[model samples]
Target: MRIGLYPGTFDPVTLGHLDIIHRATVLVDRLVIGVAINRDKGPLFSLEERVTMIETECARISEETACEIVVHPFENLLIDCARDVGAGMIIRGLRAVADFEYEFQMVGMNRRLDASIETVFLMAEAQHQAIASKLVKEIARLGGNVAKFVTPEVRKALQARFGADC
Candidate 1:
């Protein structure tokens, strides 16, 4: 079976992430959403909370597609995680030119680590191109409405985390 890995901080899986996940499932037999436990990033949500939020949001996708969607937390190198999960491909979401430059470099390094693992880039929908998890959390923390950026579950979680109605 063709398995793919999509790794990200996913602090609170944004609509952009959902869009990518939906489209990515069509390309691989199984798509594993690897939630990175990067303490350096200072994520708004804990790894467990991020995994829960992604699981709750991706339930429908997992049911509808032949592709299985798995949300797993990993802390080591992304290439190592992909290899560990038997992923033959890595799925990445590209928002703009800025994102490409960074992803491009990472892809090269990942290729060096495992030449067999391919990387696929999916462009975010125009509407979601501007919505990033960090910005969404910032807006919500400052008491702004972020219902459009993230799923309802994530929004509720954000509200509770920030102690403000978003």
Candidate 2:
């Protein structure tokens, strides 16, 4: 099977992620949403909560796309997660030149870990290129409505994680 790894910290799994997930479905036989646990960054939601958010959002996509959302609380390197999951390709969402620059280096590093693993970049829908999980979480924490930035499932997850008090 052509398995593609779409890895990210996905603090809240924003619409841009969903869009990438949507686009990825068309290119791979199976898309594994790998939620990397970034040891350096403190997240708004716990790993369990993030997993639930990913599961719920993956399910929200129409049934035609056989996308599997796998919550990998990876304490190790990102490429290790891909190798563990048997994903042949690493899929990334490219928003701007800055993202390309950063991801370019990452792709090179990942290639070094597994020479056969290919990195494919997908452009986010124009409307969602600016939406990111961190930005969504920050906006939501500040009492800003992020309904446009994420799916309904993510909205509920974020609300529950942040709560009305925040």
Candidate 3:
């Protein structure tokens, strides 16, 4: 079976992230959404909250995708996590040229770490190419509407975190 790993710091799941997850399902027998517990980045949501948000959002599209979706939390080296989950490929979303450069370097390192694991880069749909978690949080923090960028549950969480005025 072609199991693929898509790892990221999903502080609060966004529509863009879901878009990638949905598209990734078609390329693998099983898609694992690995939410990274990176304390260094100081995420807006807790690890459990991030995991829960992904699980909730993924569940909404579970039936529509061709592959099984698994939401998991991991820390440290992503290559190790990929190995642990028996992922033969690592899926990445490239939004623009900036993303390509960073992802390209990481892909090379990942390849060096595990020669057996391959990396697959998927370009984000044009509509979602500009939507990022940091920008979403900033908009919410500044009392801007982010309902269009994130799911209802995530929008509510952001509202609750940044107050009702957001």
Candidate 2 pairs with clashing backbones: none
State the lDDT of candidate 2 residue by residue for 93-151, as single tens digits. Answer: 99888898889899888888788989999999999989977888888888788889987
Per-candidate clash tally? 0, 0, 0
TM-score of each: 0.98, 0.91, 0.97
Summarize candidate 3's per-residue lDDT along 1-166 as a digit string, tens digits: 9999999998778888999999999899899999998989999999988988988888867777757899878987999999999999999998899998898899889888899999998888999999999999999999999988898899999999988655
State the lDDT at 151 in candidate 3.
88
lDDT of 2: 0.81
Off by over 4 Å in 2: 67-69
Pairwise lDDT winner, candidates 2 and 3: 3
lDDT of 1 by residue, 66-87 (tens): 6799888899999999999999
Best by lDDT: 1
